[model samples]
Target: MHVTELLKDWPCTVTGGRPRVQVTGVTERAANVGEGFLFVARKGKRQDGASYIEEAIQKGAVAIVVDRPSLSELPLNVPIITVPDCRKFLSYASARLAGNPSERLTVVAVTGTNGKTTVTHFIGQLLQGLGIRCAVIGTIGIFIEGRRMEYDCPEMTTLPAEYLHPLLAYCESRGVTHVILEASSIGLANSRLAHCEIDVGLLLNIGQDHYEEHGGREAYIAAKGRLLHQAHAIIVNQDDTQCRQMADASERPTLYFGAAAMLGYSTDLILQKLAIPGHYNRLNAIAAASALIALGYTVDDVADQISMLALPEGRLQRLEQDGVQVFIDYAHTPDALEAVLQTLSTICYGKLITVFGCGGERDKGKRAEMGELAVRYSSLVFITTDNPRNEDPVRIVRDIKEGFGGDCSTVEAVLDRKDAIRQAIFRAAPGDIVLIAGKGHEKYQQTATGVLPFSDVAEAEWALSEKTYEGKVEGGSR
Candidate 1:
């Protein structure tokens, strides 16, 4: 694509303007820039993206986009496109570069403190079941027609604007009719989904999370609200006052789903018989059902596909072969932990055991609250290590212990996460339910120094098998 035609819609002051420059790709990182690539510079949390400008230009960046005038003072002989907001500029320009594939595809974006992955997956499964070619993009990975696609971004829930637009274009090339995306608060705030043209935006529920990262609760919510603006239509959880408030202010068409809608409507069989357990999962169903209905499906159409809808990986996933009733979930936040614990308490026949830990450099305030909720619901609690990125793992554990009564017997701390899982699973008796919370699908734990290989599901399965083997040995000896 030519530079002039690609950025025709964008308001920019061009320096060293080369109207005939052909662009090959778009990126924010200097390391990713190559010949004919357009590098957009912006401010990041820890470092300014502009600092990498010299490196990008050196690596053969054909064009540059920057918001700040001072950052564009370099005498580089490239077509520099100066805009007011480069992040937003990146989104629009990348879409132009990718043939504006979002316009050709029906895009559905779902957001919340929790359930974004599950809800996004639910919508994709429903649409695919109904014979619509669909793709799902979220925390786990990007999927195109049921196959997980390998992209540059493995860390971001919502891919950055550069890679995101190209992914959308790829989806369109594959004949995908609908694309379901999981929008995180931070991603939305960063304008990752700026020019994608969302068809139906769904807000599952907003609970306490990422307080420190967003600087407070309101800012976090405001970041979430940005998705609703770009959406042509929106589906909101009426049970959440914050979602309701956002819906009330929206000028677009809206459909609401929650307890009120579920209880009031009689034909809602979609919520009752979900294969995935939990009231929160039921609410996730409602959110997905509402999105499907918004996209021109009936409650009956969704009801037919409801049984096939399952939770995403590590979401209250049960172990069938294991002797004890073991469930694993990615409930890192206080609200998520409380919900999962309460849900498990009802189905558990014997003692409920919970193993969880908080991440470092995250919302520390939720650590104690999660600990309190764990102790409140479980008969035995084992506090373990979560990805303590750049923070002391011991400190994180200590913070969690502060929430509950410091009875040494009631709750125990095992700093090593693997040992914690082993102790919890090995000690459980028959009819006991072991709920492993936090680090559900993640394969590694980010420590202060470096990332360590870990998976809660993997550790639980090993522990369960060992426990079963031990029982077999005793029985054989007897």
Candidate 2:
């Protein structure tokens, strides 16, 4: 495409020269620039892209798009386009460059603190079951028709606009009729999903999370509420007060989903049969059902299919051996942890042993709250390390211990995550349910050194295998 065509819709003034250039690609990172690529120099939180203009030019960046006012330091040899907001411009420009694939398909965006991944997956399952080809993009990585599309883990829940537009274009080529995406608060706040057209937006429950990034609860809620205004129709969890406020504030038509009837919105689907456990999961089912219904699917049409849909990996994933049931869940927040443990408390025939830890560099306030929940709910609480990225593992464990209020009898701080899982499984008796919280479905553990291959489900299976091997050895000796 010509440089003038890409900037035609974008608000910008081109200077340097009017020489027409054929742009093959667009990128923000100077290292990713190639021949005939348009390099966008936008100011970031940590580093400024403008600092790498020389590097981008060195790599054959044919044209430059910058938001910075001072372009005196930049090379004036190439066509320079100046815009007020480069990030917003990049979103629309990249979409245009990628052929605006999102506009060609029905895109449904799911957003919230928790349940974004699961709810997105549920929506995909519902769509695929109805013989509609669809794709999903979220924390579990991209998926096409229930198959893993990418082997590597995504760095964030939502892909950046530069990559996202192209991915949607690829999905369109593959005959995907609908696209279900997990829209994160940071993604919305950063304008990652600004260009993508959303047909139905699902807002699950919002709780205290990413406090450091958003500053406080109000800012976090406001950031999440951005989805409400972007989509044509919004589906929200009426049970969540913040979500309710978003629904009420939005001018778009809204659909409510939850156990309780709010404003005469019936939640008859909550009582339907579901393979997944927990009341929270029931709420997720309602959210997914409501999204499909908003898209014109009948309740009865998807009711039977709902029971066959599997829960997303690492979400209350159960592994059973010798009457010991081990459940691996990605419950990193205090509210999520409480809901998972509370659900298990009702089903536990014996004791509920919990092994969990807080991630480093995140909201420190949730550490003690999670600790208190574990101690109050579980019979035995094992505090261990969970991706203490660039932070002291011992210090993270100490912060979690503080939440116990000095009740160290039931709480044991085991810095090693594997040992924590081993302790829980090795000590479990018949009918006891061992809950492994945090880092569910995650294949690697991030630390100060680097990310190491780790899986909670894999560790639990190994521990169970060792126990079975030990039983065989002892019995054979006798």
Candidate 3:
């Protein structure tokens, strides 16, 4: 694409030279700049892109977009355009460079504290079942045509604007009709999804999370709300008290989904029976399915497809051993933990056992709260390590124990996650349900220095098989 045509709609003040350069690509990072690349010198949280102006120029950048006026003082001969807000302009610049593929595809973005990944996967599965070529970008990984690329990064839950154009380009080339993505609070705060035109924006329930990064809960929610502005339709969980406030701010057509008995009118797509289990999962499914139904899919069509929708791995997943049941869930927040416990208490006719721990260097306020909730729901509570990255495991356990009233008898602290799981299993008698929370689908366990390979689901399966087989042999002898 020609540089002149691309910058024609960009909100920039041309300082030096006309927009005559032809552009090959758009890049924000200096290292990615190459021949004919239009380098965007924008300020970021940790580092300023303008600092790398000399480097980008050396790497064969054709133009530079900056928000500051001093960019004109540079001795470089490359054309420089000054925009009032380079971060805001970057969205359009990237879209213009990629030929605006978002305009062609039906983009459905799901944002909230939790359930973003599950909803994205659910919507992707539903769309695929309906014979549409759909792609998913979220915590689990990017899924293109039902195949996913498993890459793990600490902040990989959300899609970044840099990967936006290239992935959309790939989808457009493959003739994909729909794309579902998880838009995280941090992702929106950083202008990651600003460029993509959303067809339907679904906001699941919000809660306290990322306080360390967001500074507070309000800032985190405000970030998630940004997606609603660019959406064609907005869907939210009406049961959430704050959700009504978020919905009121939307100017587009809106709909609400929840399990509320008196919601003015019946839900367009009610979750009569959810195979995934948990009240929270049902709510997430209802909201996602309602969004699809509102997008023109029939209620019956969505309901039919949802029956076969398997729960995303490591989310309240169940295992049976010698009449004991174990559930593995990714409940890392207080609200999420509460929801999981309440759901388990409903179906669990026997004693409930919970094994959980908080990640180190995260929201420390939630540690005691998690412990309190775990003690409230389970007969036996085993506190253990969960990604204690660069933090002492013993200290993390001490904080968790604070919620248990210092009764070491009621709550046992096992720093080793494998030993924690085993102790919970051994303590469970027949008709007991053991819940392994925190690390659900994650494969690696992060310690103080490095990450050790581990899988919650795999370990649970192995333990269950061994216990069940041993029980069978003992029964035969009896």
Candidate 4:
């Protein structure tokens, strides 16, 4: 695409030579610039992309889009496009450069504090079951036509437009008719999903998270509200007052889904039979079902699909051996941990054991709340590390210990995650349930040194196998 054509609908002032340059790519990172590429120099929170303009030009960026006026001072002969908000413009320009593939496909975005991944997965599976080729973009990774793509970036739940638009174009080329994406609050606040045309927007639920990033709870909720503006039709969880407010704010058609909706409508009873454990999943099913229904599917058409839907990996994933059941979940927040533990407490036959910790440099306030919730719901608690990046792991544990309201006998602090899992499994008796919280589906543990390979499920399984092997050896010897 020519430089002029890329900026056709974009609101920007063009300076320098108006060369008819054919742009081959778009990127914010100067290192990724190649021949005939457009380098976007936008100011970020910590660093400014404008600082890398010279490097991008050296690496063959044909044109530049910059937000800062001073950046145009460089005596580069290439065309410089100046915009008020380069990050916002990047989304539109990227979509235009990628042929606006989202315009050709039905896109559904799921947003909330929790259940975004699971709900998006559910919608994708339902669309696939109905013979529609679909793609999913969210925390787990990108999925196109029932296959997981190699694109994995844990830093952000939603991909930036520079990457997201190209991925959508690729999906379109593969004949994907539908796409489901997780719309995260931070991503929306950063205008990541600005240009994508959303057919249906689903808000699962909202809670205390990313508080530091958004400044406060109100700002966080406002960021999530951006999804409603971009979407054509909105589906919200009525149980949550904030979600209800979001639904009210939508000028487009809206639908509501929750336990109350399920009870009020007889046909929605299929939500109760979801194969995934927990009432939260039932609500997610309703949200997914509501989205499909808005897309013109009936309850009967998708009821069976909902009943047979598989839970997303690491979402209350269960492993049972020798009468001890272990559940691995991505419950890092206070609300998420409480929900998972509360559900397990009711079904657990013996004791409910929880192993969890908070991530470093995140919302530290939630650490103590999670600790308190763990102790309130679990028979035994093991507070361990969960990606203590840069910060001292011991300090993070101490912050969590404050929530315990003085040391309790049931709560034990274990710094080593492997030992924590091992102790939890080895000490479990028959009919006990062990809940491994935080760092679900993540195969690595981030520390000050670097990312180290770690898997909660793998560690738990190894511990169980070791215990079983030890028991067999002792019995044979006796």
lDDT of each: 0.85, 0.86, 0.81, 0.86
lDDT per residue (tens digit) for residues 1-478 in model 2: 9998777777777778554999988889888899998899888888988889889988999888988768723556888888888878878878988999988899999999888989899989988989989999998888999888863324679888888998999899999989999999889888899999999998898887998888887888888898999999888887788788878999998977778642244566544568777888888877887888888887777786787778889999999988899999999999999999999999998999999999999989888889999999999999999889999988888888788666588888889999999889988988899999999999999999999999999999988766643345321111
Q: Which pairs clash (backbone N, Cα, C closer than 3 Å) in model 3?
A: none
Clashing pairs in 2: none
Model 4 deviation from the true structure expressed as Cα RMSD, one decimal place: 2.6
Best of the two (1, 3) by lDDT: 1
- Write down the lDDT that model 1 would get: 0.85
Better of 2 and 3 by lDDT: 2
Reference-based lDDT, residue 76, model 4: 82
Per-residue lDDT of model 1, residues 247-336, tens digit only: 887888777789547423543587665777788888888888888888878778889999998777888888844448888899999888
What candidate 3 gets wrong by more than 4 Å, as runs, is: 13-19, 70-72, 149-155, 260-270, 446-452, 462-478
Model 4 residue 145 CA deviation (Å) reads: 3.6
Per-residue error (Å), model 4, residue 347: 1.5
All candidates: CA RMSD in angstroms?
2.6, 2.6, 3.9, 2.6
Ranking by lDDT: 4, 2, 1, 3
Clashes of each: 0, 0, 0, 0
Q: What TM-score does each of the candidates earn?
A: 0.95, 0.95, 0.88, 0.95
Please give the lDDT score at residue 303 for candidate 3.
Answer: 73
